[model samples]
Target: MVDIRSPCILVCSIDVKSGFCFGCGRTRAEIASWLSLTSQERDTIMAELPRRLETVERRPRRETRRARIARQRREGQ
Candidate 1:
């Protein structure tokens, strides 16, 4: 068996809009069946991850420290 690496970053939240994991850029089905997939399949999915992640909305609904700071700076406060 080949040693296939997992793309999980431990940020398991799924983005509702894209139907992809916010961190790993994989669908629920894909994630669930990952271990059963062949190495070539895994590699193909891995190659598309960057493109998939680009379509995911990563912003938190609530205010974050980094966002707050950026906002304050923009407001010159």
Candidate 2:
């Protein structure tokens, strides 16, 4: 089986207006069936994410735990 990586950044919030996840740029249905999909299907969805993100009112939240900590430290200082 091919490894088609997920775009999830652990921020699972869905944007109400766009109906897509702010992190992975997928709808609930797409995320639900991701593991069952063929590699080609995954690739197709992956290809569209960039364009989808561009149009989305809010961009994906890719903040890692460490980044968040660092950001907080910077802001606190």
Off by over 4 Å in 2: 59-77
lDDT of 2 by residue, 1-77 (tens): 56668988766766767878776788889999999998889899999988776656674346645457778999995
Which pairs, if any, clash in model 2? none
Clashing pairs for predicted structure model 1, backbone only? none
**Any idea what lDDT model 2 has?**
0.77
The 10 consecutive residues of candidate 1 with the worst lDDT sum are 59-68
Best by lDDT: 1
lDDT of 1 by residue, 35-58 (tens): 999888999999999999999998
For model 2 the local lDDT of residue 9 reads: 74
